[model samples]
Target: MTLFSPLHLREVTLPNRIGISPMCMYASQDGQVSDFHVAHLGRFALGGAGLVIAEATAVHPHGRISPFDTGLWSDEQVPGWRRVTALVAASGSVPGVQLGHAGRRAAVREPWRAGAPLDETDAAAGFAPWPLVAPSALPAGPGHAMPAELTARQIAHSVQDWHDAAVRAVSAGFRFIELHGAHGYLLHSFLSPVSNRRTDRYGGSAENRLRYPLEVVAAVRDAIGDGIPLSFRVSAVDGAEGGSGIEETVHIARRLAAAGVDLIDTSSGGITTDRSTDTRIRRGFAFHADFSRRIRDEAGVPTATVGLVVDAEQAERLLDHGDADMVLLGRQVLDDPNWPHHARIALGDDSHDSWDVRYGSALGPRARTLARLTASGETPLTRFSP
Candidate 1:
């Protein structure tokens, strides 16, 4: 199948294989989405994105990555998200949301501020640092505070929170739900031995480490019902010393598939905060292809490859070669919200018919005029060139 092909996942059909990867805008106010979010996310849908997944929305307020990150913790947040989903759906794109808990990564500043953990000075400035939680009482890095270990009761409550958030996501009109089980967040922290040092049922052996995330997947799956597609994003490899590898991730993927995860959005690294100690995989075009392909084949689950997937040909090649079932674009789409439509032209469909009528009607005549000018051996820049 080509990049433009439709992907039928459960009861939902994505209009095309190219999906907008959830990239945190960090523009919310106390977890409430504003008009900025509606305008920001709506553009991709208007620009021809087949699926638009909202950023990592915290299931609980304490799980926020930054004070400004969006959340779905209460009913008040539903109406705002409903506006986004409604606009996206009206634009002929499937709307999805990623529910996440940042765990020890919480209470940090935005990426532009170097993502440093907030402290008293920031608290005085009204950006107070909240207590972080994890499976073990360990800091994400040297300077970060050691997070409080989550009690069994608290862990159970967190699972319920995910379920509640999934219900809210459904109420907000999202057809797909993804659980953020990656990047050294709460679920990934529990899965990795490097971050999790607990001796309880939620830690230790690989199967034990799989406990909490599986519970979350099951809870979310049940909450959203069997009709909506459920996706799980995983850091395919920890990319750090003593971290889990592909084989371990494969095991996790197999369990996740069994637990009702439909797609694995393969990503890597982010397990540790220390840049020096953090080992990163090669940053190449479609960097996650091998990881995604392996998970798709070995785990027998559909996969979506991210990381440097910039163009249509590369995305099509990945799917054609069985590297992934879909390709997710993050920064590329940010650079050009209409990249999907542009890709159609790059792939030889020059009619611009796929574009929304408002854009196509205008652009179509301009494209023909340019072609006619070129055919007549007259260039628009010929008169200006020295």
Candidate 2:
């Protein structure tokens, strides 16, 4: 896809397909954002991303995977997030936040701490990992606590939490909202049979498993109104034997569209104990051709293809072939914050004048000088941001 083409979702127009994926920052203090987050997301906006989804923020404190996770459950978080949204928007990129609940994955150590399970002492200090909740009483891995099955009341409260979070996101100046329903988190736990084994209405059959996720989407949409674009990131397949499969994910996408989802962000795995079984299939290459195409053609909703999607040409081909509406770069963008600028050149949008106007001033050169350098392939380069 041409990085600069407008992507219309409701009233919002993304300036490009190049979006910064929601990578967990784990920099929040007591679920409150700090200057670190503002600088992190704001730089992407300034770097020329058309859209910037803030890291996966929890809907409630207990829903956090670690004590450092951002939260929207309190009004106090809004002001800090607003500071970030304003900075991102000032640079012309749309601001967004991905709301999620970690469920059985909750209360773990930060990624820098190796993301390990904590003990009772750690839990008492507010870092202690404990039994998580899910559709069933299953644990994510060895040494992880087997979660408790959620009651109907708990499920209802969870939906309300998402609804409230959406409202807060909008108030914080976010134009888009994405529910983090993938990666073996709370919503994905319900969607995948590998973790969700309940016989209640929220489990067992595929329809039942999909119910909670769909409800959260509906609730968020209702909370945010039709003017804002709402999206859901889903593990299109569990990548596990007899786990949530393509067909089930497709069905879930269809229902999500009907329930007011603007796009299906297709991701996989994170719901199983075994990721090695399919690691060789070219990471992030699983659903682009088959599942994403099926969902877009059959369900008639735009889809965002994620996972290992980095190369500019590969993303363009996926869009040209009508497989997905948008390509979300995770690690690639992480590795190169200026990926969009490079992609613009690759897609033949190489108006050196435009790119320079956006970035070259930071290089201490006049537009004409930068253009001359770019045309001559003699622009001096230094170490790029990762």
Candidate 3:
């Protein structure tokens, strides 16, 4: 299939193979999406992305990566997300969201603020840090505080929280729901041997480590029903010493597929806070393609690959070569919201037929005029050139 092909997952059919990868904007207030979200996300839909997955939204307040991250923990957050989904749907794109819990990575400042853990000086300035939780009481890195180990009751409560958030996501008009099981978050913390040293069922063995995440997945699937597409984002490799490798991740993907997950959004690393200490795979173009291809082939699951997927031909090649079923773009789409439509033209559909009527009606004529100028051996910047 080509990059412009449709992807059918459960009852939803994405208009094209290009998807907008979830990237936290960190622009919310009290976990509510602001005008920035509507404008920012709506533009991607309007720009013609087949699937538009919003940022990593927390399932609970304490799970937020930063205080400003959006959340779906309460009924009050539903309507705000519904606005996003409605606009995206109206633009002919499927609206989706990634549900996440930052775990020990929570209660931190935004990436621009150094992404460090908050301390007393920050609390005095009104951004107080909350108590972090994980499978074991461990700090994410050197300067981060050691999080409290989650008790059995708390783990059960967290599962219910994920279910409740999934219910809210359905109410918010999302057709697809993705669980953020990567990036050294609560789920990843439990999965990685480097981070999880617990003696409980939620740790120790690989099967035991998969326990909590699978329970949450099953619960979320039941909450959202069978009609919605469920995706799980996994760090294909933990990129650190004693972390889960590709083989371990394949087993995890198989379990996730069995638990009713429709797609595996393959990503890697982020299990360690110290970049220097990370033994991550090389950061080449389409870096996660090999991992995604393996998971899709061996585990028998559809997979999405992201990382340096910056162009139309490159995205097409990923799908064309069977490396992934879908190609997800992060910064590339941010650089050009209309990358999908532009890609359509670059891939030989130059009629601009895929663009929205409002923009195409004007741009269609502009494109012709430029082509005519070039044919006449005339250049718009020729007068200015030395």
Tell me which residue pairs clash in candidate 2. 1-316, 122-128, 123-128, 284-307
Model 3: lDDT equals 0.93
lDDT score at residue 31, model 1, on the 0-100 scale: 88
Candidate 3 regions exceeding 4 Å error are 383-386
Per-residue alpha-carbon lDDT of candidate 2 for residues 62-161, written as tens digits (9 for 90 to 100): 7898888998998889999999999988888899899999988887887777787778777677665645788788877766777889999999998999
Better of 1 and 2 by TM-score: 1
lDDT tens digits, residues 253-361, model 1? 9999999999999999888897877889989999999999999999999999999999788888999999999999999999999999988888899888888899899
**In model 3, how large is the Cα lDDT of residue 293?**
98
User: Model 2's lDDT to the true fold?
Assistant: 0.82
Q: lDDT, candidate 2, residue 79?
A: 98
Ranking by TM-score: 1, 3, 2
Q: Assess each prediction's global lDDT (C-alpha) against the native.
A: 0.93, 0.82, 0.93
Report model 1's TM-score to 2 decimal places. 0.98
lDDT, candidate 3, 1-386, per-residue tens? 39999999999999999999999998998899899999999999999999999999999999999999999999999999999999999999999999999998999989998998998988998889999999999888888888999998999999999999999999999999999999999999988998899998888999999999999999999999989999999999999987889999999999999999999999998887977678988889999999999999999999999999988999899898999999999999999999999999999988878888999989999999999999998898888889
